[model samples]
Target: MFYAVIPAGGSGTRLWPLSRAGHPKFLHTLTGTSASLLQATVDRLGALADPASTYVVTGVAHVASVARQLPTLPDANILVEPSPRDSCAAIGLAAAIISLREPSALMGSFAADHLVRDTDAFVEAVRAAMGGAEAGLLMTVGITPTHPETGYGYLRCGDAVGDGPVSRVAEFTEKPPYDVAVSYVESGRYFWNASMFIWRVDVFLGELSRQQPELYAGLMRIAQAWDGPERERVLGEVWCTLPKISVDYAVMEGAAAAGLVGTVPGDFGWNDVGDFNTLGDILERDERGNVVIEAGDGPVSKPQVELLDSERTVVVPRSGRLVSAVGVHDLIIVDTPDALLVCPRNRAQDVKKLVDGLKERGTSYI
Candidate 1:
């Protein structure tokens, strides 16, 4: 059986005002669907894994919201972290807990706030990656790059693994310079790192021990007490102590260097939705190429936005007040109850700067 592990720990600083510390992007429906991103992620996994076998690792603040969103998930399956400790700690702890029950079970970790236009292809890709997992190799899903994207990480594909569709991961590259990104796309051997991982519980724990021994030891202790009365005490004591690092840097990079990592290249129309510009690109646009997203889950109607002579603009109306745009071109305006963000559409990725400025002021908006 395969187990699904979801890491919903990011605040999505780039998507701030809409995504805050108290309410992350995973809980919101950036997509046109009625289901929130987190729910959509779990729903997409239903084709391969059941709700009982799925585990969501989220922060203490959002645990209640996660429960309300996913009622079918057992309370025990919702592993709560006392604080945000990066992806390695969150996903490692989930793997540790699953190892206690079924050491050899194949477990997959996917982010909670990504947009997948084709669920069918995604399921197939995960199934393809499973072969590598069964062979004791760390498996990751790689998206066929359509363009030279300097924002996302890249995974260089090596030789095929055991007559399977999966390829050995030659090297893992972080967000590269523009020139380097162009070369990667021209080579055709590089694929966008989708941050989707599948591996046996035992194999993953073993790799964690080999790469991040301190974190592995802490997770094992917490996992041992997970089902007992000391669950809260042990988690509280150990979770914060684990180093703050991403699984890509702490585990996958080292494993790839050791030739124990494999990837399945797929073109499943994947979008990380990390920034407003990317979100605007995926969402529907108006006649003049304007995208307006209304806040709250309300009936569909004409948006409360009035745009005049606006082209390629993205506006988010959440304050329940009509927003008027005049002579704006390629601009992003996000109106919230407590904060308002206005910047050029090209600067969407820099929205995190506004979030950081607010945080520096000790503002309550974050």
Candidate 2:
């Protein structure tokens, strides 16, 4: 069985007011389902990874809440970072620890907040990717593009590497311009980089040592002391010294250049749930195409909202007060105890701008 590592370290600023610094978007159930995104992610991978083999890498601020959400998780499985160093350090640390325990084990590092609707299909894709990883290739599950989505990074796919259901990752491209995204979709050669990666722990650590020598060295030191009494001291000394970089920049892109990277084409329904508009699309809506999300304590099955002639809108009622909207179309209304967010659906991705402004003002609402 493959070992699973979940990196849950983002504050999710795009979905502010509802997603705060202490309580992030992963903690909230954006979907109508009872499980949060983090819980859903763990459950989705349960068929492949047992509780002991699964590890969650999170920040000091979220460790308690993460443990509370996942009662079955072992205490040792929760790896806490001293600070927010980026994805590279978080994932590299997990890889290093897993390597010491079982060098040849297949370690699949998945995001803690991504939504995968078809758990069966996701597991099948991971199994397919495992074949490539077993063959000494770094594997990633590439999501099939549905439209000209410019918000996500794109992966350029090439010819098949081997007989297994995996292809060589030709190139890794960041979010491009509208025309470039359109061309990518029209050419049918690109897949959205959802950041779900699978590979042998030893193989991945070797690649990391090759690409990010300094970062890898630091993580190894921390990992060696992880099980001992010097765990916290080593982590404190080495973590902050490591460079803050993403795995894409530190490893994957370089490995793809060396022809050591492959991917499985995953067409399973996936959603990043980055912003309110994306959440609005996933949730249930009214007859007039208005989605009212009920949040906070108490039995909030139905949202206390009154939408009049509102079409294609999203309303989040989190403050236990009745929210009334009239003739407001394509708008997002999020009401919290201390802050209220009002933005058009087209500007949903720009909600982080408001958070930025509030942060500059040193307000607690952010």
lDDT of each: 0.91, 0.90
Q: Candidate 1 overall Cα lDDT vs. reference?
A: 0.91
Clashing pairs in 1: none
In candidate 2, where is summed lDDT lowest over 10 consecutive residues? 294-303
Give the TM-scores of the predictions, in the order they appear.
0.97, 0.97
- Name the regions of candidate 2 deviating beyond 4 angstroms: 296-298, 301-303
Candidate 1 lDDT over residue span 1-366, tens digit each:
999999988888999898999999999988877889999999999999999999999988999999999999999899999998899999999999999999899999999999999999999999999988999999999988888889899999999987879899999999999999999999989999999999998988999999999999999999999999998899888888999999999999999999999999777889999888887898999899898876548774765799999999988887877889999999989898888889898899889888899999999999
lDDT of 2 at 235: 92
Which regions of candidate 1 deviate over 4 angstroms? 300-303
Tens-digit lDDT track of model 2 for 254-296 = 8989888899988788999999998888878888888877753
